[model samples]
Target chain A: MRNSSLIPFRSGGGILMALIVAAMAFLACFALAGALGASKLAGAWTDGLSGAATVRIGAEEGAPEQQLDIVLDILKSTEGVIDAVPLTEDEVAALLEPWFGAAPELSDLPAPAIVAVTIDSANEPDTSIVQARLDGAATGAVYDDHGEWRGRAASAAHAVRSVALGALIVCALAIAAVVILSVRSGLSAQSANIATLRLAGAEDRYVAGLYQTRYFWLGLIGGIVGCILALGAMVSFDALSTVSRALPSLDLSGYWWFLLLGVVVFAVLVCVLAARITVLGTLRRGA
Target chain B: MILFENVGFRYGRGPDVLQGLSFDVPDGAFTFITGASGAGKSSLLRLLYLDDLPSAGKISLFGRDISTLTRDEIAWFRRRIGVVFQDFRLLDHLTAAENVALPLRVAGAREVEYRDNVAEMLQWVGLGGQMHIRPPQLSGGEKQRVAIARAVVASPDIILADEPTGSVDPEMAERIMQLFMEMNRLGKTVVFATHDADLVKRSKKPTIDLKSGTSSGGVAA
Candidate 1:
């Protein structure tokens, strides 16, 4: 009739359990955010590289200007090439400004003339055919489509996402372990009470239900607090981004709340299930 | 109704606490199990309540062998029997009213149905004024009363009490005995295990006296 008959409203061990659950939930939130952000970044990198290519004309015997025109003509004639525009000398200098400081001597350098080509999404250009056509018209020409860079970016993102996923899984197992240990301790602490209830005709399910209900509430409260703290951390980190570029700026604008809600629900379910299993397993063994 | 035939029990590799014991308690019989300390009174009671299985024997209750019942069934059987411990094993966090209503709650009775009944039962045990108080706040005699109230509140067919009045004063002991007697008169079988010889002589009930893991029957008039 009253929860007092089932379990104490507050216990030192129970408080410890709640704190453990909160810590697990907090870590889980970060893991989930990292996985989602990494996946998004990977998608952005892939999309940015998918439709573009670069054609470089080396400075040779003939004027580099004639060579750039020949490379552009080859690319534009290709079936899947959408557009081709040769980079102006000033534009090429701007690209090198990151490595070499801006100086009036930049024009004196024998930089290769480069043309940017946009490929049609519906029809991909056959690089082998374009390369063959360029070889005959313009010797020492090179085609770069950024495939290697895209591959490296995808691999890096995948590794990051994998680590985040692994962290989340470890957090889940840790939460379950905490619940099982806490419940076992609670049972030991309340053995006398449980014996009395058993003698009064309580079934194992009935007894286990009491602990399950208690854990459900404990997990819910802890999970919400953990989520709030995690959100605050994210906001603080975002704010720090204004002062320095070292901190990662998580784009919380998309579906982040949904992920948070999922984490809370998942935490609650883990607690309840863990408590129920521990209680039932102990009772069965005693039986 | 209970039957034990050639029941032998021991804890692990230790000596047998109950050796080849045979006994039967019929329905509606008020029986006392009298024995000195370490005479197997508690062990025998634990066997009767299905808390421990007899190492070697057959135990039957209500025409069904205990060994044949599943765990769930054993729980259901326990609902028809009530047990009161010598230490008044009331949950300390629960109020006297909640403690008394435990059996009913365990039976899955709704609060609306048993709330008033629990209050009335506590009142019958002279604990009406202390219903809201936890066991820690109750006197020894008051705690015993609450224990008794809890045992019989569900109107079980049989009540097993281990030294129900062991911790109370003489006057309170007699009062507790009267409550058990009242339940017996109302057609509930009552069994009590105690070393109290004077109370045994006064009650004049049939008793199974246990000595060194053996039992001898006696009747006092």
Candidate 2:
């Protein structure tokens, strides 16, 4: 009966089914984004003092060349600190390319001096103690403590992730609503069919089972289609960002499989629930 | 096997469709319910089938009180009875044999056990060669026979038919009525609703007449 009832969901050129799936995909992607972002931020926060950290050395603008020796000397002796090198103009230009495009606007600006710091894997040096040593002599030099900002950055990233997941949940709810409403409307149109079955001694479960079966299939087809579309969109995005690995990106992590599962489940559940209500209501009205 | 005592039913706040309608149908009896248009014959059949509960009286079928029965129980009760509507409510998609086999299937009979019986019933109704034809393809008389076949195939305890012969020719009407009579003789209570005076007089079944909301009549003219 469930299969027989679902024949109508496929009867049309599949309009209702397409919309339902698209909604599922939309929710899945949004929820997946949150998962991706949170995972990345967590990875970044935990390994804050690894191969990636900012190194700062205070120096007067006119005397950077003279102050370079002392800063380099301090960096060499610092415990658990790897090689510290001042950033060249080309490295900064490459970092700025994504924001300003490949043709960087270089005419009116002098490159701000940046230090590249690598800390040892086994331990990270305390930057504050080093900061005390170079304070008075190197006036403009400050130790690069990127970890100071990691907490705030991780907090902000986590916030974005929460919102993305919440949006996904709302999307799931909306998909459920859409499927439910369409199922109910379809049931109304098919009331005569339902009444005939009831008159033929079909039980409430038997009659309602028809609607449930129809909705479950509708949700599934729709979900699979929507997921495929989202996967396509993500693939295209991945292709466009080939050279830039540091910029914010979305990748399907281990947890995203759960989200995909959830999308399909949500679709089926809404359809079943909606169909049950519709069938029971019509039968109750003695139609 | 069916009885209605002081049964009064209304659509809503409207006047009664069937008011104080007291009637009894004995087991295996064939009876005709005759009245002019809008005289509540259909309403009376509706009550007999438990399609709708009467607003104010006790109705019984198979000796069980129906007025206080739950919806599920009423549904089960309906399975013990069969009906043929005037419009010939055969599913347009189902074949003639399939339509006839419906009630038995509804009663949860196994396919292997019912297939041969359904085929015999369809043949008995004079649709021997058109078992595979759908309702749309069948002629009016053929469709009515299909409906008749459907009503009796389950061998229900009672059969209620509303205007069973309204769409068929006189000869066909007589044949269909004979089918109902045969079922009655086999111990199934039967009620036929019609306004055809010729059918009423020809059949000679006890007539339950309704006129201006009363049973015992003053106008036999």
* Interface root-mean-square deviation, each candidate: 1.8, 4.1
After superposition, which runs of candidate 1 have C-alpha atoms over 4 Å from their true positions? A1-5, A9-16, A60-80, A85-90, A93-113, A122-139, B68-71, B168-174, B196-206, B217-221
What's the distance in Å from true for residue B216, model 1?
Answer: 3.9
Tens digit of per-residue lDDT, candidate 1, span A1-287: 35354667456766787788788889999998888888888889889988998888876645988888778878878899999999898999999899898988988878888898899866878777788888889888888778788899899999999999899889889989998988898888788788788888899888888998889988998898888889999888878976788866787776889988888899999999999999999988983
* Model 2 CA lDDT for position B205: 82
For the second chain, the TM-scores of the candidates in order are: 0.96, 0.93
Model 1 chain B TM at 0.96
Give per-residue CA lDDT, model 2, range B67-140, as digits (tens).
77776777688787888977777777667887777767655676787888988998899888998887899999
Best by TM-score: 1
In model 2, where do residues sit more than 4 Å from their true spots?
A: A1-10, A47-158, A246-249, A252-258, B104-114, B217-221
Q: What TM-score would you report for chain A in candidate 1?
A: 0.88
Q: What share of the true interface contacts does each candidate keep?
A: 0.62, 0.30
Tens-place lDDT digits, model 1, residues B1-221: 78878888888889988887778888898899998989998998887787988888888888888888777787888889888877888988888999998988887888889988999999899988888899999888898899899988999998999998788888888888999999999999988999999999988888888889876774321
- Worst window of 10 by summed lDDT in candidate 1 chain B: B212-221
Residue B63 in candidate 2, Cα distance off native in Å: 3.9
